[model samples]
Target: MNPLEAQLDYAFADTLPDIGHTLDVAPGVRWLRMGLPFALNHINLWLLKDSIDTPDGVQKGWTIIDCGIANEATRSAWENIFATQLEGLPVLRVLVTHCHPDHIGSADWICQRWQAPLWMSTGEYFSARMMSAGLPGADGSAMLPHFEMHGMRDPEIIAKVSQRKSYYPDMVPAVPHAYHRLADGQRLRIGTHEWRVITGFGHAPEHVALYCADLEVLIAGDMVLPRISTNVSVFAIEPESNPVQQYLDSLEKYRNLPINTLVLPSHGKPFRGLHTRIEQLNTHHQDRLAEVVTACATPRSASDIVPIMFPRALDAHQMTFALGEALAHLHKLWFDGVLTRRLDADKIYRFQTHSAY
Candidate 1:
């Protein structure tokens, strides 16, 4: 077994809820898994049992957290779940931890179905709305130049990128015109448990995680994970951002929390060992930073150093993320004075080790 993985202990690691089915993970809280077509095949959604007041009596309903992507198949799966799992009750509200397409894809569809208001962080809510509305910053063309500037010179890849439309609208068909904004340190009552919003950055602009101190359980959006590393990249939209550092800072904030807390991540199974996982992630990034510094011995563009950082076959879709990540690592080393970036005669920017000076 890998030494890094040994630090974490999982609950129901060998089991997953069947499609359109739900698994109980806590009191009044259930786990629902949804299918996705990407390499990460599934995303976990939470169902919180709550009730509403009516003229006659109390009405029982569920508050759904994180709707799956907006697609025919996903839509069908959700419909099936509602048909079988609801037990005659309707959806009360839709709470989103973030505005990633997979998290907020069916926001409009689900909200309209139950006449529920969408809840999410202001940044995530507005960003999703703007992207869905065909804003200027929400297109492949907008990102193509940034990718190219960071060493993505492959014509075929650039052509594919240029023609590709924003995947957000396709996955996230629409956003609710209005939303209930959640902020860091806000308390929300779902069912009988009070879940506090713990906002973090680097994965998304304003990713929110819900923590129930009494339950000792945390719905860690993408802020922390048990297995795969979270994507912390520099996008064209934020050319000068240092997300790598911001991500680490967010992880540190969780270290002082109870190490025995049950962590329900968006990707992997629920696990224990928050402190161990945070240290593992910190070391992983440090190792990657050292590798980037060594790779900078020769002037190289982000694209040119992609192989050094990630030794894998990347399709056109994966290439986009790889370029962004490579640029992020380069930017980190440059930002830390480990490397210096300069444009060569060909107008291509490359990074070299500070020792080269």
Candidate 2:
């Protein structure tokens, strides 16, 4: 654990659920880990013991929180989970937190396999469908031009990024044609407890985090992570979006939760420090924004700011997010009037301190 992580209480510090298995984290909630093909090598999924009234009477089963990417390895892992872990009860419902591939990639498959209904926020559901279908603005094709406009001009890097047109579709080949919508503040009864939906923005369209007061546990999807700060990016579809501001504002929604709530995040170990983690996240962004403002004393493009923010060698996949995050900070500063933006002679956007010129 790093210095920052030492400040929080990790409920499961000495144990981790192996792939295809689960460990109980809270009352009626179990934790599962899935592998991802990225620097962030894993995503945490949850299984909630649940039952619902049906025509046959009370149907008992489990509700799935997020699905791993649609790949053979992930599918095989799910197969193992189904055979051994589910205790013979079928999955009751599939609820995705957002449209991200790791969260919803295998949603259709899982739903189809168990004949369960898919549940997600309207924005996330539609965004998943659009991106899965490789629609104009949401597809990987738009990323190159968007990054280029923000001044990503490296030919080798550009070549790698241009080849990612099939990125989303490759992982998430399809989405369920229908879904049950999740909304902010809506109460959902999964098993013995009721969880309130807490929608957050900037990370994804409408990310839903679940809070169960009875259990004193918060399923903080990607809203408040323990290890790394959640990625708040200005993607191609929302060019002028100030997601940094949106994300910071969204953090305020969690202040009402109890301080010692056990937070089961989508990444990192389960920890008890809701307010502490939120403060860490806020301070993380504030520090990043300060660095950006300092760097913008001279004109800088999103690409120019990427190195200052990331300060490491980036692969093609990481570069996309890095550039987007750089632009997100710039857009936030621009929106706050701390910086000014202009299109340079090369048709690339650049930002500088408002008082620079």
Candidate 3:
């Protein structure tokens, strides 16, 4: 539908992994897909062949990357894969791409079963724990004020937003206590190939995407998605954070990889043309920024800009993320000095283009 769509081609656009089945994508790397109850119905996880030590000797196993959410159906699917695939080998290690529930939900169960430790970026590890820990001041406490300040005055919608604070535990009830932290450019060997950690930001703090230059493959977590743009938002937790800039910088990081590299995104089918996708994502936000600046002719709050940017019917849940993203775009404009923000008479924040900048 856009320039990037015309520029990039899906290597196997017609192919998709069946539920509970492993599709051989590359040497020693198997692609697995799982179901989710979201509009984005499914997520793709990876199973990398590996060998690990036991009491007697080394045995073949797997390293699961990006576990699916915690649920009975997902649990059943994993059970089926363990039985059908892996040839009776155990899961040697659990690697998480990020802290979102869809990506790390089953980590606790899988790790406990195989006695494997979670390998995740330091930020993602703690973010997942703190987010799902059901802490007193952690989850929903900040949303009330943030939404209220953003001009969400409807009592019913405000009530729904208020209830989201306690909703994390059901999605991700528990996480393991210990994990091995991954760092940028850290080379890790799996099976026969070496994967270097590529740290990305904005979408999630310190999100890690794995790159195997030897195979020309990149397990682009949420960084280089093929179809839907990753959500880059300014949550109530960090209302002033300039995530849009961080997201742009993160896309720039991916530009250094080969354009024709095979990209295995967490969502969507595997595809090539990383450069084209990067261009699309960058231009997507830049266009959004321009639209936002134009809209600021009449000092607009985040809620005021959501319809301008998204222009769709949003449910209560969708509205929450939309507001956060709208504010994120505004924060980037303010951060770059393209716009100025101030409190209005109603004690709501609004942005307007500065004459000089």
Candidate 4:
């Protein structure tokens, strides 16, 4: 077999987990994978069998994480599976890694059902509510001026900027009025096992990575993954943010985690060798940054540089996301002093070297 195929086989053999066909991980955790009407296809929900001692024969259940998009099918799956598979175990708590819909969609439903507390980083909790509430301050609306200023003139693109704002509602079964905020260094107990929360920035507001030192297992959420690179797009709320820089800073926090920890990711199969995958992700971005630098020699608009970086092309809907990703990298370079941006006569923004600065 080719080298890439061989490496994948090894990663899966040594690191990939076989949760189930519908579920992407393993069976011990009582995982349930649910479909979402998005390009990414699915999101996973994990139910850790709570081994906590109880007097009433009440089995305790705690969710390892949340699935993003919520719908009748997803909710139905939870009802059918939780009742049968869990044997009526009470959902003790819901732990969310971040504010993304696929990860936090069913949070309110589960929390409300069992009257359990929802736990997430303070930043993500607030952000999730904003997106879930269908408010004007949501990320897409916050991004309008940034795109308008950058020359995204297609009327459909503008309309989609509005439509994309509410994409999370499908997954947001309901919004939680309050949540128990998580922070770095906090310990989360699931029955007898405890997972330490690790915080990171850039990908989302205060993304959490739960690490169980005893079990050598980690619920990585979307902070780190085996296959596709996590989306680190710059949003309208922070128009000039150096998202790439923030994402790189977050990577340093994961480097010291035990390399052999079994990683339970949000999108891909669970695996070990967390550190090796971390290094690969880091290298991939560094290479991309280098390419962006090379492309900026003659000063180009963010839209122009997008095709050069992401040449495969995408659907109209996907293009909006792609443009945002491309802009994020340029913003990072601009803030890092490697590139400088200025508005032209038509208010179109362009970036080039900032040697004078």
- The candidate that achieves the highest TM-score relative to the unseen native structure: 2
Arrange candidates, best lDDT first.
2, 3, 1, 4
Number of the top candidate by lDDT? 2
| Candidate 1 wrongly placed segments (more than 4 Å) | 52-58, 355-357
Q: For model 1, how does the per-residue alpha-carbon lDDT over 23-130 read when each residue is reduced to its tens digit?
A: 898888889899998988999998988877789888789999899899888888899889998787889999998878888998799999889989999988987887
Give the per-residue lDDT digits (tens) of candidate 4, residues 63-100: 64775456677677677766666655677777888888
Candidate with better TM-score, 2 vs 3? 2
Screening candidate 3 with a backbone cut-off below 3 angstroms (N, C-alpha, C), the clashing residue pairs are: 140-165
Clashes of 1: 0
The parts of candidate 2 lying over 4 Å away from their true place are: none
Better of 1 and 2 by lDDT: 2
* Candidate lDDT (C-alpha), each: 0.85, 0.94, 0.88, 0.73
For candidate 3, write residues 219-277 as lDDT tens digits. 99988888888999988777789999998988887777876799999988899889988
Residue 216, model 2, lDDT: 95
**Per-residue lDDT over 1-357 for candidate 2, one digit per residue giving the tens place of the 0 to 100 score:** 789999999998869999999999987899999999999999999999999999989999999999989999899999998898899999999999999999999999999999999999999999999999999988898988989999999999999988888899999999999999999999999999999999999999999999999999999999999999999999889899999999999999999999889999899999999898889999999999999999999999999999999999998889889999999999999999999999999989999999843
Candidate rank order under TM-score? 2, 3, 1, 4
lDDT value, candidate 2, whole model: 0.94
What are the per-model numbers of colliding residue pairs? 0, 0, 1, 12
